[model samples]
Target chain A: GENVGLHLPTLSVQEGDNSIINCAYSNSASDYFIWYKQESGKGPQFIIDIRSNMDKRQGQRVTVLLNKTVKHLSLQIAATQPGDSAVYFCAEISDSSYKLIFGSGTRLLVRP
Target chain B: GAGVSQSPSNKVTEKGKDVELRCDPISGHTALYWYRQRLGQGLEFLIYFQGNSAPDKSGLPSDRFSAERTGESVSTLTIQRTQQEDSAVYLCASSRRPSGNSPLHFGNGTRLTVT
Candidate 1:
């Protein structure tokens, strides 16, 4: 079975500080990894993604790091804001499968 | 361009009853997927449809759950003899294609509450 798990269920951070959410995946064949943000009463939104070939990828204010050797993935948010408070999930997909396997999710709470 | 659309933002059905949830993917997208999310839980893949190929239903929880897609436009997920444990949010997502490189865009989801 393919399992993707997060190290922490909930992470609280102060505004203007950096936040890092960690995820561990069991499938080494997973070639693509993605980070998603889901707010209350909304669907999960794509934040950033990193391919197996790349160790890191960056977006507007977010960065995704993939360590294929350890089968670990991470999402880093710069200057965390109150609006960034949401549930974050890391998903992985292998070349053999079309579906994405998602982790349980980490709740990000930012204090003003 | 409009994003993926799901109907019946919320559904409440009694146990033993059946319910149908709908999804309309983005016009040009050729892939659609259905997932379930329990309270404070992650997305659980249920089914996937791509182009004209047979849908991948390996993720479906049981025989009580089934889904259908007409071409690449619309999809419907049906649950039979729903149980209280079936209460969850049914989310629909779509991608331009089935490739791993394509990112899936999601819909708000239909929150199903089975009593």
Candidate 2:
């Protein structure tokens, strides 16, 4: 019954612009969150992750923000590039189990 | 050469046939997971294996599905009497620990199509 959801099914952004994708999760008990990127014909690749104890985490060019009060999570990509075109997914893992539930992906299309 | 590995990247078979998908986790990873991704849908958890503990099969859809793992090694998911609805990408992922906090490393899935 753990359901993680995305706010949008797709997003379009011009190359070099910033892109933001949002996700909503139902489990308040979940303590860990991760963002992944999947390219055509490839599996999901880990981009960044954050613990519930922290509100935000940053990686090379991606940032993950978690809002426990609203049960919302978002991923921001800076200076989006054409190579960044892919489906993005947010996953959650609760303290009770090792299973990581994934949300429906948001496809990001970057126009060069 | 250091990531999860899956075999038979693609497979096609008749509806009545049986198919097995294989997953090889990273060298020292102890947690392995199997998930199904249907067209236009999110990944559906199928099974999980950790160290020497009993595998958690809660996510399996039916009795037609079965999976095996030996001592944190390779895993095989077998589907008996596969149906057309079984057509999907079977994704396998592995994590270094069973702490439920580590991020997972996924392998390109095996795309199965039951005609």
Candidate 3:
């Protein structure tokens, strides 16, 4: 079965450092990808997204890079902060369907 | 503007009991979705509603689970004869347009514990 998965279960980073989260997806048909952040006791919040045609997209202090050739996706956060600590998930969707398939999350722990 | 809202932030029910979870999407938003998250796991798509179109329920785990939406307003998810496996956090999200271009706004979600 096709699925999206993360490279690591947990990542510990010190404040003011750059943090990167990696994801691997098996479905070649997926055209849209998104990243979400879920804090404890809260629902996942939309972070950033990228289409298959584009390799990279940037938001406030965050960047999403897509490598379609390797079926890999990565999220980069600059100047990691305490507020950035959360569980991050990557989701993919194909044009033919409305379902957004999510990957197992990576827990980001920003140490002060 | 208010974001998506869900009722009964937490629920504890005994096995075999039925439960209904409610969701109120952002005003004027046309796309709504339901998802389930078990302990320490990513969300699992459950159902989707887009305007007058019939809902896409391909992700529903079983016949025991069902959902209903009125036009583009409130939606309810019903679980009948609930089992322990049904314990999870139910999240609701709304998008202003097709999620292909627009991002989804999610609610706090309802936490269900089946004993």
Candidate 4:
């Protein structure tokens, strides 16, 4: 089973603080990774992405870090805002496949 | 008009019935995908189409589930003899290509509730 999963089901953070979400994947052949944000009733929105060749990639207020050796992935959000409260998922794409394998997801709760 | 569009924002059907979900992808996009999301769950890959050619239907759950695309314009996912477990949101996404570099553009999705 090449499953991609997250370490925690939920995370709580204070406003203006940093939030880190962790994920682990079992497929070693995966070469591409992405982070998606999903609100209460909306589809997943692409946040950031990283390739196997690169260890890290940054977007507006988000960063995605990948460690191929440990099959680990993380999404870091800086200065968390109330609007950032949502479910975050890490999806990976195998070198041989076109479909993405998504993690269960981590629900982020921001407290003011 | 710029984003992917899915029809029947909400569907409520009885068990053993058949249902068809439609997806209208962004114009000129060659790649389209269908995914399922259960209540508070992760997205599950259903199927994907690269073009007018054959699609990758490996992610489909059972023999009762099938999908088809018409010349890269629209796609329909058909579920026969649907069960309660089939209740979920069916999402449609499209990308410029099937490559890794192209990010998927997702639609609002069709919420199907099988009672």
Q: Per-prediction TM-score of chain B?
A: 0.96, 0.94, 0.96, 0.96
| Lowest lDDT block of 10, candidate 3 chain B | B51-60
lDDT of prediction 1:
0.89
Screening candidate 3 with a backbone cut-off below 3 angstroms (N, C-alpha, C), the clashing residue pairs are: none
Q: What is the C-alpha lDDT of each candidate?
A: 0.89, 0.88, 0.89, 0.88
Q: Scoring each candidate complex against the real one, what DockQ results?
A: 0.43, 0.44, 0.39, 0.38
Q: After superposition, how far is residue B83 of candidate 4 from its true place, in Å?
A: 1.4
lDDT of 4 by residue, A42-95 (tens): 778889989999998888989888999999999999999999988898888876
Candidate 4 regions exceeding 4 Å error are A1-8
The estimated TM-scores of all candidates read 0.94, 0.94, 0.93, 0.93
Comparison by DockQ, 1 against 2, better one: 2
- The best candidate by DockQ is 2
Cα deviation at A47, candidate 1, in Å, is: 0.5
The best-first sequence of candidates by DockQ reads: 2, 1, 3, 4
Can you write out model 1's per-residue Cα lDDT over B34-61, one digit (the tens) per residue? 9998887889999889964545888899
Off by over 4 Å in 3: A1-8
**lDDT of candidate 2 over B7-113, digit per residue (tens):** 88999999999999999999899889999988767899998888745458989999999999878889999999999999988999999876456899999999998
> Would you list the clashing residue pairs of candidate 4?
none
Give the TM-score of chain B in candidate 3.
0.96
Worst 10 residues of 4 chain A by lDDT: A1-10
